[model samples]
Target: MSIKLYDLAGIDDRRFSSNCWRTRFALLHKGLPHITVPKLFTSIHKISGDNHRTLPIITDGKTTISDSWAIVNYLEAAYPHKPSLFDKQDSLKSYSEFLQHWSLKAISFPLLQIIIKDIYDRLDPIDKPYFRATREKRFGKTLEDIVKNSEDNVEQFRSGLNPLRVSLKHRNFLSGKKPLYPDYIIAAALMWPRSMSPKQILHEDDTLNTWFKTMLSLYEGIGSKQPKEWVGI
Candidate 1:
């Protein structure tokens, strides 16, 4: 049976849906055979042809899964003979959850502020008005207003990544020398700007940048090197 991912895409296929990227990272880590079907941000509903709405939706044979963490859990359970993600699933499950939580709070929160416009500018035209208006409503401010001080905010965002930096001081990846769920959670989040914007998101001298380069090189450049139309690759 074949696998297809209703992956999120922007104006071009050089898309950066961080959550979706998490799922892709997991699948590629497990060495699964799959293909991605790009879905514009506002058009994700078409993936299910029902009330279901979200990208990075995957189907293999008769199974369908949404949410990156759940998809990874499914992949590990179903493909036990393949490479492991959590390593010892039962022992590391909660630890992975902790990493996910940390990524959401520490990385996703501030990173979203820094990259909101980059994301908006990359959205398909059909997704623009809705993306802008809905985001404005949810954020209670204009996109321009939201990102006005992003350059200043970037420093603070980098500060909050202290844990990752301190941890990386001794190891090549979050999981010692080998990349794992924790590594993917944080590294894939950085792909937000890597996919769309040319502004250097990571500080040039930060160790995080070095770690991220390694993350990009993983799985034959599948994580960072997507097909690009906006920036030079």
Candidate 2:
């Protein structure tokens, strides 16, 4: 059965959701050509046919699957002939949770302060209100107020990436020789800001930056082809 990827898109049709990007990378790794559906925040429920209102949803034939990790597992089990996201070694599921939490704590949290306003600005007008209300409630401040100090502190935010830098010092990817879920998980996190903001979040010579460039070139440059509102600002 053919696969369908329900992506979360920005106002300009830019797909920027980190979670959705993870699923996209997994789909590419599996060599699955799926239909891409661009959805705004409020439209998620319409696609899933349930109360659940999140993206990275896929409809494979008559089966509907949600969440990036679940989607990855489903594709792996269904398409065992394809390349594995788990590296065909130990299942990265437990490690994936660890990575997800650390990613949110170390990467996404700091990165969010930098990109939060940018994300708000890029949202479709309809999405802006919901995004702002929810995010503001979560952060307890105006988006602009929260991001105003990011410029001076972006350095500290990048420092959170030290572990990634050290990990990739002698490797091209997190999964040793090839990119895997571990790599894709973090790449998706970083790619979100790249797609929205015009700032250089990493040094040009950074190992993670190099690996990220390689990721952009993978899957036929799907990662880089997505339109960025601004870059290198």
TM-score per candidate, in order?
A: 0.93, 0.94
Span of 10 residues, lowest total lDDT, candidate 1: 224-233
Question: Which 10-residue window in model 2 sums to the lowest lDDT?
Answer: 224-233
In order, how many clashes per candidate? 0, 1
Write candidate 2's Cα lDDT for 1-233 as tens digits: 66989999887788898999999999988888788999999788788567557988899998888988789889889888998888666656667767877898898888888889988888889899999999999989999889999987688988878888898988888878888888899989877988888778887877887898888889778888888754531
Q: How many clashes show up in model 1? A: 0
Question: What does the lDDT read for residue 72 in candidate 1?
Answer: 86
TM-score of 1: 0.93
For 1-233, candidate 1 gives per-residue lDDT tens digits of: 66888888886577688888888888888888998888887787776776457767899988888888889889988999988988865656677888988888888888778778878888888988988998899899999999899989888987888988899998888877788888888877888778866667677678988888788888887765675422332
Best by lDDT: 2
| Candidate 1 Cα deviation (angstroms), residue 215 | 0.9
Model 2 regions more than 4 Å off: 91-93, 230-233
lDDT score of model 1?
0.81
